[model samples]
Target: MKFILASASERRIELLSRVIKDFKVIPSDFDEQTIKFNGSVPEYVMKLSKAKAEAVSSATYAFSESDVTVIGCDTIVSIDNLILGKPKDKQDAFRMIKMLSGKVHSVYTGITIINVNFDIIKCDYACTKVKFSNLSNQDIEKYLCLEEYEDKAGAYGIQGYAGVFVEAIEGCFYNVVGLPLNKLNKMFGEMGINL
Candidate 1:
C-alpha cells in the first residue's frame, strides 16, 4: 500500500518523516476557506481534515486503485472561544501575538486517514493546551521581525523562535508543533500500518 500526505505544509512533511519512511507528499487542491467554522474546534478541524483527504483521494493526478492511504490534517488555535487562523498580514500577526502573549490557548489538530478502495476512513484529533510567558513588546516585535508567522496558525511556531514564549504545555508537544506523532502512530497501527 502507498501512503500519501495531502498537505503542502513543510512542517507536516518534516514531522511525518521522523517516523514513517515511505510516503508521497501530494498537497490537496482543496480550498480551506470553503469549509466554515460553526461548531466546536474539534468538529471544525475534523471537517476540514475529511475535506482535504477527499480532495486528494479524488484528485485527477493522484494514484488510482493502488491500495493507497491518504492522510490529511488541519490545525487551529482557540483562545477564549476565538479561532485564530494564519495571520492575514504583519498587522494581523502582531495582533495575534499580542493577544496570545501571556494567555493559555488550545491547539487542536485533526487527522484523517482514508483508504479509497475499502471506503475506510479513520478520523481523530489531538489537543494541547499551551501557556505563554508574559511577552514584552520587544519580544513580540523580535518574533514578528523574524517573519515566520505568515503561514502558521496563531502566528507562532512552537518549534521555532516562538518556543521561548511557551512557558508550559499540558499535552503532546508534537501536537502544539502541528501533528501529534505518538497518537498518529497508535492510530496508524490500528489500521495495520506500521510507522
Candidate 2:
C-alpha cells in the first residue's frame, strides 16, 4: 500500500520513514490557525488534524490516487491555559522560552490517517509531560541565536540544542518530537496496514 504524509515537517517525515520505507511527503496546504476548537488542547489538535487530513484527501482525490493512505498531523505545546505555537519572531521566541523555563509543559500531537476508499483511522493524540530546567537569560538568548525555534512549537526543538533544557519527559519521546510511533503503529494495525 502507498502511504502519504500530509505535513511539511522534515522531522515527522524522517521518523515515519523508519517504519515505512516507501511513502510520499505531500504537505497539506490547510491553514491551521483557521481551526477553532475553543476548548482543551487535545480537542483543538484533533480538530486541526482532521481538517488537515480532509484537505489532503481532497487534494489526493483530485489527483485520483487510489490504494493510498494519507496521514496528517499537528503538534502543539501548552502550559497552563496557553497554546504555544511556533514563535512569531525572535523576541517571541525568547518570551516562549521564558515561560517554559524551569517549568513543566505538555506536548500534544494529533495524527489523522485516512484512505479514500475506506473510513478514517486515527490515534487521537499523545501528550508528553516535559519539564525544563531553570534556564538563565544567557541560555535563552543563546538558544534563540541558534534559530532552532523558527519553525518549532513552543519555540524550542526537543531534539536539538534545546534538549539541554529538558529535565524530564514523562511519555513517548517520539511524541515530543512531533509524531508518536507507538500510537501510529497501533493505528496502522487497526487499519490492517502493517509495516
Candidate 3:
C-alpha cells in the first residue's frame, strides 16, 4: 500500500513527515474558486478537502497501486464571518494583516483521507482561535516586505516572523500553521495507520 498526500502545501508535508516515514505528494489540481462559500467555514473546507482527496484517489495509477490512500487538507482564516484566503498581492496582504491586527480570528483546517479500494474515507476538521497582538503599520509593512504572506491565508504565518504577532492561541497551534499535526496523528492512529 502506498500513502499519498493530495496537497502541495510544504507545511503539511513538513508536519506529516514528523510522524510518517515517507509519502508521495500528488497536488490536487481542482480550482478552489469553483466552490463558492456558503457561509459555513467547516463545510467549505471539508468539501474542498474531499474533492481533492477524491481527485487523486480516482487516478488510474492510484487504483493500480497495491492500495493507495490519499490525504487532502485545506485551511482558511475567518474573522467576523469573513473568510480570508491567500492574499492576491502586497496590497491585499497589507489589508488582510491590517484587518487581522489585534483581532481574534479562527483558523480552520480540514483533513480528508481516502482509499477507494478499501472503502476508506475519512473527513474531519479542527478550529483554532488565535489572537494577534496589536500591530503597528510599520510592523505590518516590514512583515509584508518579507513576502512570506504571498501564499499564506490571513497574510501571516504563525511559524514565521509573524509568530511574534500572535499573542495567544486557544486551540491546536498546528491548525493555524495550515495542518493540525496532533489531530491528524490521532486520526491516523484511529485509521490503523500508526502515524
Compared with the true structure, the alpha-carbon lDDT of candidate 2 equals: 0.89
Poorly placed runs, candidate 2 (over 4 Å)? none
User: What tens-digit string does per-residue lDDT give for candidate 1 at 129-186?
Assistant: 9999999988899899999898999998998989989988999999888889988898
lDDT tens digits, residue span 41-109, model 3: 999989988888888888736357777778899999999999999999999999999998999999999
Listed in order, each prediction's TM-score against the native is 0.95, 0.97, 0.95
Where does the lowest 10-residue lDDT sum fall in candidate 2? 115-124
Model 1 TM-score (2 dp):
0.95
lDDT of 2 by residue, 1-195 (tens): 678899979999999989999988889889886987586899999888878888887788777777879898999999997999999999999999999999999999998998866766574888999999999999999988899999999998799999999999999999999999998998888887887
Worst window of 10 by summed lDDT in candidate 1? 59-68
**Which ranges in model 1 have alpha carbons more than 4 Å from their true place?**
60-62
Predictions in order: lDDT? 0.89, 0.89, 0.88
